[model samples]
Target: MTMKRIAPLIVSLMAALVAVLVVGRPEHADAKADANPGAKDVIVHLFEWPWASIASECTNVLGPKGFGGVQVSPPQEHVVLPGAGYPWWQDYQPVSYQLQTRRGDRAAFATMVSTCHAAGVKIYVDAVINHMAGGASTGAGSAGSTYNHYSYPAVPFGNDGFHHCGRNGNDDIANWGDRWEIQNCELVDLSDLRTEAEYVRGKLVAYLNDLISLGVDGFRVDAAKHMPVADLQNIYSRLNGNPYIFQETIEGGAGEPSPSEYTGIGDVTEFRYGDVVGNAFRDGNLSGLQNLPSQMLLASGDAVAFIDNHDTQRNGRAKLTYKDGTNYALSEAFMLAYPYGTPAVMSSFTFSNPEAGPPASSNGTTNAVNCSSGWACEHRWRTTANMVGFHNAAYGTGLSNWWSNGGNQIAFGRGANAYAVFNRGGTLNRTFSTSLPAGTYCDVANGDISGNTCTGTAYTVNSSGQFTANVPANGMVALHINARTTGGVTTPPTGCGTVAVTFASSTTTVWGENVFVLGNRAELSSWNTSGGVALSSATYPVWRGTVDLPANTAVEYKYVKKNGSSVTWESGGNRTINTGSACTLTVNDTWRS
Candidate 1:
């Protein structure tokens, strides 16, 4: 779909590929799937979204919803193919290393990166390093740089910098059977860079280093299979820091490059994951979905899982996409709830033509995203967005309380923190067993939880950690400890003088975890983890939040790290704070643990 000419081939060859263990990854490829530890673990690919739009979304939706990172489309000067109707794939053809594209200019891109970081969201760029513009695209590029086959001058690559494999009379990759040609020759007549050469590698490293200097946290290596593993390893080693790196390696036939071969360099996008998980939901089968990790090609830590992506959604390879309606929603929810690989949710724009670009001007400058009109915004769907909380809440816990109806119904629990049930057959009323504590929980799947109330459905778990409810057909019921109903700060007792107390905690955290302040007082949620006042990571390494408290009162409080389902209390005893008669006060403390 992106002019790689490999999508259809990979899709048809999926049946022949086999899953293998990934071993012998290079030591330099210590790229983690979760770039920002202690943040949420989900990465939403806002495909073709403008830089400015992404910044706003980070502050408004992603940060609030607990998403970890965003895989943005390429942010470099690329080819502009107006004659081809300004196809979406045009962005894949590079004209230069300049950070100027349809998305925005260099200044805007830098602002986006800073804005997202301030909101606790990391940015992963889609790095297209396999080749430059195709030989047929002869003209000025998006940033007015002109180039021909192997003659780009902006980055100053010449014919000597490319690989002319001298095969098939045109030097194009006509045979996928040959491993050398697949990696060295031009893909679809695009000029392939000689990655083995030190000069070429240096140029590539500079491009990547430039992005890293701009505070880009990670990269989705586009068309990584075209470059050898050694070349990638060498390039990665040269990076300033170990930002998260996941490559797009479409599994090929037996002799061709295997996705497993690239795992040593970094995480690989497990295309097979989409097939196994998507088909399970599309077929309405819940029996075999639990064993997904063992069935995947890469290990849980090395795989980047997704139900559908930009390429698959355009091609017919994807089992269920945004077009599939409820089935797709259920599939996304299941992917999040199930403990598998690192999840990257897809948020895309609507398109009937697989080659069509997003809504843009005649000059191919992409317009700002408008979700209600052209964008699918699948990540914002109630079932998908709310499930992120479930994923975070259930982090580090293993699946328990597994139950199935031997048909299209299933229920499971994530330790004692979260529980969920899916009903695809019919409205089945049943009492579900769980390990959650007794409390009234908001069913996040059907509604949003605000304060202590649920906007839609609510269920009460008894002391035995069991709840009785009728799950609707084609629906789900999800509850996490964070969504429990609890009355918080009951109108700060009538005549008490209030002072704004700002709590600042300097502590580090792992993925899916956040810092909160709670204490033994009505104003501080009374030590209820569910009702604790959450601190923001706007100024990271320093979690800060302000809350009103009774003046001139001694409050026993402590900072705790909370994921959705579990709470990790600070070591030692409780921290005591005094709210003086001053109108406002600030308390700065380090993490005791």
Candidate 2:
């Protein structure tokens, strides 16, 4: 079958299936492209936008702006929170797997997906499977499906799929130390699911496969860290292969699952990158970004880097303040230029209260996301948007000719295809080696190309590979060789391939035992000791153990703590592994792997 013939057939099939499943029309081809990767560098998170609005944005703004994909809010039926003023978290509550929510119904969602796909912009759904609504009595969701905290009638999940909250509603995760409880226990009063069950896995897979059949490219698994690694692996394996799966595991420090656990199944969200970039930009410390290369090298392939996300924006008591729009723009632009994990930029509207929803009307309907509506479309800013073009032009490239003042000024070449300078200090006037074939190129940060001429006051790159440009305070400059000129370096090196590592232990405990315990200190280790190497620690109550490993190597090691006069491991002999290079160990049974 030729590409032309296969395309229509696929669309027709999706339309028919979606029509039969629910009373709705199929999404247009352009909406489907929101998750599929095209020859672009940007993926806008169209928060709370309806399918119709999204389709329009693709044709009017995203397509012309050079966006590769769009991560849409959860499309599944969710809790309708009227008390919280219908906040965005309402989507976090899963009433059913049906494609119906605040954004649109099943038909509208399908149409949006197909429409985006037609425009060469992929659609990635934010899959929230960790838990149901925080606190809700009635269970008729936005899709009209009946659900209860103890049971979901539409999906028909029973007690086997849930875990009861122990005294104080903690479930004793600190004591029992079981993966099952962590996944099945309530999170912030939200009902969790038992993903390990084959039936549950099948349902999840079916929902995702339905989306894939509708032309979605991947999913953003929300609250993934709270789930079991094995269960996630199982669910992902059952879903359509080749779909982009980015798990949300907020591991900031050295230890924890390290995003490596889920890398085999799909890319994991790198939450720490947001903090690093946000802090560096806000403080005007460009040198803090110099260590990005090191972090990228450690991230391997599972890193799904991003700026401020929904949770972080809601929880202001966190790192990298994103309330400031200027700093947010600088951070996003920097991420676009830096060679890091698979990048996903945050496109959000302005909000005064942390729990506030996107710009909404008096009737509680989400307002259309437009620049004039007080929504900070940071992704559309001149500097940020141009950097997206630069990123697309320099895809698969590595950082070369890195030049930094070790302070508030930095510049680097992206495989000679593009070069960028970030000056957080005062105005910057520097002549840097672009490493591009001598030719004039358009400064993407400032302007566009038209009829072989760079329009606007965009800085120009001379034929000598030496371009002197001034980046005003809190501003940046990026020059792309392919923006207006031809014949520049296009190739990049292929680094070492990745590896998959799993950890197992003799104990079937929910949470692993505390292997290390000191006065006011405790440590835990969960490694797969059956296949990989083992880790040993000294028997010191107040002492901690540290381990270092290579990139892309998977090994399991157990933890041992110092007792009064002896060393002891977790009671269940719990074992864990580290998959990446950089990791840390802290107290309180926390293995910052």
Candidate 3:
């Protein structure tokens, strides 16, 4: 998130005028690698998360759920402003390119990259290359490197590397219309780097290349609009590989640099996406969203869409947050369900004060993530997390079977792979036509399918491709091929001779202990405690997972709660199931006290 919210009233007036002007969408960059390297397209920004916590989440949560990538906070040495109660923006102020901060040291950063890669999830670093620390910040950085205005000795950037654009008494940006001042002048008194200078470009390239060498797959270039597009292209050309680059170019008025100017090089952040989607959901208007792509600043392929980022969430621009409850969840679900740009989901910590930092120690080092407490963990919401599977299953499919009440109720489909309905008003009772084949699907938005049982609601599509449902107010029902509750046909098709067994356990757990299942067969780890198949808590108090067990086999399994090395087995004789010749089966069990 960029701090470009200066003179918003003026910018808004100009933006209204610029919206009508037609401009050809720039061709997307051919040199860029896949923004999401995994099979899934959704990426989550774990805002202000510690390196160790992020590594663990990648293995246990993101990778297992098919999340493609994680966008981490800046890993470079940055200003530490303890006097100001250690504001979150401090991490955006770079003191040097050294990979050391409250998050972790260079070694920890390297470990995080490799760990996430092993889980098949990519890491995109928030690259702060357009500037250094603010003019007022003068102190030793998080890495113990001293830094002052225009003189970061750790990065060896002397005063010559900065631009002293002679305008506005303090050389800070004041005119929102002047393109030159917007790019050359300091933004809110941050020491702007002269990106046009070769020396400065070389230093930026080195920093990015260093991260690449450590296995980082991409970058979220902060304050990208403040740099010349040519300068960015030149720097990108020198980087090791074709890393995914999404520039932060907030859509501005006609005179200022437009997001379109930056899309030629790579995908640009579509800030308008949040405002449009947020307001629609907030105002209970579903009809306008049908024209969502036309209302955006960039083309779908050249844009990175998001509802609210770290900055927008605090700046009063966000129409909804975790505080908005159901509306926010619906907004995220709509973003994933709709075919738009690559979606970036935000996972933020709760904050009362706008400038307050994340949950941290006395010394300001960010603490490990505790989703039940300080963190919102919105990305892990059953609706949001499960929508990722819907998005993936619906990939390469086009919109079909569109239905709407023309007000607050709507339903749509992604070809034959997925279908969804949203009701922001009263109970919506109607039959929905879809392209999906005849079968049973779990309503992922409300619950999940474990084995053959649906935890929330189950809807069966008739051979004619239609189902009747009563979607409640502020409620949603989404289904996809990946979450089919019956039959052996999965999104990626399980091979023959194996049956899908979904294990649903109605058991509670302490904070640390998690529910897992181990059984007599190899698929169930042969009662090996270490090899227990972990179940998902997305729908808590009902841990569930689907395992492909051999057909025509008798399996004995027991649910256990594991906290580290300790395992608490359910107090019961072994529960048995006969995997008959049927392709799918479900075994529902309650933990015996």
lDDT of 3: 0.80
The sequence of per-residue lDDT tens digits that candidate 1 reaches over residues 280-309 is: 889888878777788888998788899999
lDDT of 2 by residue, 55-170 (tens): 87776766555676789988888776665676666767777788977777888787886566545466788887765544346647787776665556666655565556574454
Instruction: Give candidate 2 misplaced runs (Cα > 4 Å).
Output: 1-41, 165-181, 252-257, 296-300, 317-322, 367-369, 458-463, 485-593
In the range 1-593, model 3's lDDT, one tens digit per residue, is 45521110001323223322321112222233333332355889999998988998887877666677899999998888877777888889888889889999998998897677656577899998888887775778898887777767766655667889988877888888999999999898888888776656667777887787676777999989899887888777666545778888987886888989887777888999999999989989987787789998799888899999999888888888888999999999999999999999999999999888898878998755557558889989998998987887888787888888899988999999999998888999999999998888889899876666678898889888999998989999998887787643643323223455668899989977888899998667789887666676655788766565666888889999988799999997999988875444667888898
- Candidate 3: residue 258 Cα off by (Å): 0.6
Q: For candidate 2, give the lDDT of residue 353.
A: 69
Per-candidate TM equals: 0.78, 0.72, 0.78
- Work out how many backbone clashes candidate 2 has: 55
Between candidates 1 and 2, name the one with more favorable TM-score.
1
TM-score of 2: 0.72
Q: Which residue pairs collide in model 1, if any?
A: 25-264, 38-510, 38-511, 393-564, 393-565
